[model samples]
Target: MTSLPVIDIDPFGTEVLTDPYPLERALLDAGPLSYLSAHGIYAVARYDAVYAALRNWQGFQSGAGVGLSNFRTEKPWRQLSIVVEADPPHHDAPRRVLANLLGPRAQRRLRAEWMAKAHKMVGKVLDGTPGSTVEFDAVTAIAEKFPPRAVGDALGLPEEGRENLLPFSDFLLNAFGPRNELVAAGAPHAKFLTTWVMEHCRRDALTEDGLGGQIWAAADRGEITHEQAPGVVRSLFAAGFNTTVHALAAVMHALVTHPEQWARLRAEPSLARIAFDEAVRWASPVQTFFRTAVGDVPVGDHVVPDGAKVLMFLGAANRDPRRWADPEKFDLSRDPSGHVGFGFGLHQCVGQNLARLEAECLITALAERVETLELAAPGERRLNNTLRAWHSIPVRARLA
Candidate 1:
């Protein structure tokens, strides 16, 4: 087989982390797979290649670690996630346990309650404003405020220390990148966040009817061991809130920037579900994940050698022209069902249904109450190695 093309780009640098589309395009244009000389890793940006890598997990495994530092070669900074960073047999039980715990029936039970909470939260925010046209930062006031409260309540976490969720999530996502300044900056608080998260995962800390309680119940049934319970609960905490928070912010940003789409949603509020999926496709929240090749894995014309770290660019793949028509345009009419924004294959985000439910409720609430959603000021992007998040989104919401 021919050698892989090498590109001298820093995939984890601040510039690419802040704005990655240009580098994404370059990676896609180079070949099916390109060696990033800066990081000495193979990267795939095209949709087909990314999808293939995710689907063929046996060839490209996650058990070694899904970050820059391979668990097989270097000691991981923390315990590896049983759900996300494991392979079959080892991955099967936890995946099955969490799948059942967070499945359709579970989300169905939470839907009505979450919807009501969404309306209540939106009402309180709007009521706090002076007049009919209310101005606020959508990121802080709406997106960031809603998910942690909603998901934290579901997980039965205490309200006092719930504020630590975002920072912990930021640190976790940053750790997926190279051990750069961002990860270094968060190292000081790692112990504090780890302790809090571990404490909340215990059976005694959870509400009887909450999702965490359900996972423990599964352990009691011998579906998973008592020892495995806390790890599974930690998986839920790690995966649940941050992705939804950023995704909601992304969808709102997409709608406000595209006034016509906002108008459509305002007219037909039922379009909220499709609008959310479209936004996920448009601005993928979780941008990149690394998979270690268990053996020689072939792309269109090259092979990723055994034990090599292969990076899949989910954000770039979501907008690949080869897969999407008018991919750059954020059109609500398009069917975005198959997008890899939440990932693809066996490890596809297990919490996607919850994220969808949260987005649907919040977006529907905004559509029902706001006649026009327009930006009040230039929005700011919060840079992280894995997440596409907004620092602030100042918006003027005209009441319906």
Candidate 2:
């Protein structure tokens, strides 16, 4: 019997997570697909297979869950999120409910509000500065602040200990991995996840006009049960906070390095939406999402057996040479609309519009306000098995 090729992914290495060059090179060399022994899963690392896996969700169903394991086979650390883990018939209702709340109408309504918040945050960061160095990561920290705060207010969260939202959201996503240092670090903080969310759903803790109120209204209309209301809010908060932060940082980093792109952005600020999508394709925030095969299926040259777990390497796929020319280069001219950055198929991220809007607000504001952008210091990466993040990005700017 020919043994399957086994590759180990070092989950704890900062270098591996931050740069990911080693893993990318290995995957490219190994061909389209390879078995990852460390996580006991098969990964679609090259462009073709990654696109195939993403598009053929019928064969690569999401009912297994998007994390490292199948929620159907193994229970999630928290309850399954309707948006990320559910299949079609079961996925329809919640998807519709969340979609309506995040659609174009909602974007139009929330635009001024979120844009105003983004401006304030950027202004504060740039307060009296043309050449003063501010850590680019601080912008990420501030940019991420709006989502939790606005989402919290919209959810009608009580003032009691509301700051725990992001920390818990970070912990919860980190919990998807196996019992490693990341998991261990997050395990102790698990209760914060439950309590912070539970408090927001209480009748007394809700804001009258918030999204939490809308969720409650959905319950009243019998769209969702009362028991499930808090989970909906929890899902939004968890999904919104970290993803947006990482996304905003990715765009900022891109602009910092590419002076020409920054000039183009400043020249035509309307490209903000396109710029955000391009950045997402260029730097996928969520690295890999797992899918368990319902049965044996051939992906490229390999026959992955039934009950096997397939790791969809979004990062590798985003820059796949088969799908993208110069796949590694960060180009703003490309149409990244169909990219799997927000994921594809039935389990595509429901909050993608929200993320785009937030990115648009921040990126456009910087384009309008900043005269120039360049790296003041070396950029650094924060490596995680799943998340693509930066620790610090020193930037110097001149006001426009």
Strongest candidate by TM-score: 1
The positional error of residue 362 in candidate 1, measured at the CA in angstroms, is 0.4
Write the residue-wise lDDT of candidate 1 on 1-400 in tens digits.
Answer: 6667888879889898888889998987887899999988999899999999899989999999888888888877777898899899889999998888788997988899999999998888776433389888899998998888888888877788888888888888889999899899999998899899889999998987888898899999999999999999999778887888899999999999999999988888889999999999999999999999988988889889999999999999999999999998899889998899988998999888889899899988887788887899999998888898889999988887
For candidate 2, the clash count comes to 1
Local error of candidate 2 at residue 216 (angstroms): 1.6
For model 1, give the RMSD to the true fold.
1.4
In the range 1-400, model 2's lDDT, one tens digit per residue, is 3445567875435557657767876776677678888767887877767777777766777777767766767756566765566677766777777777777887888889888888987887777656554444544455456666655555567666667776776776775555567767777777766676767656557876677788778878888777766667667867777777778788888888989888988888988898888889899988777887877878776877887888887887787777788877777787887778887766678788878888888887677678887887787765555778766677878776
Provide TM-scores for the models: 0.98, 0.91
List of clashing residue pairs for candidate 1: none
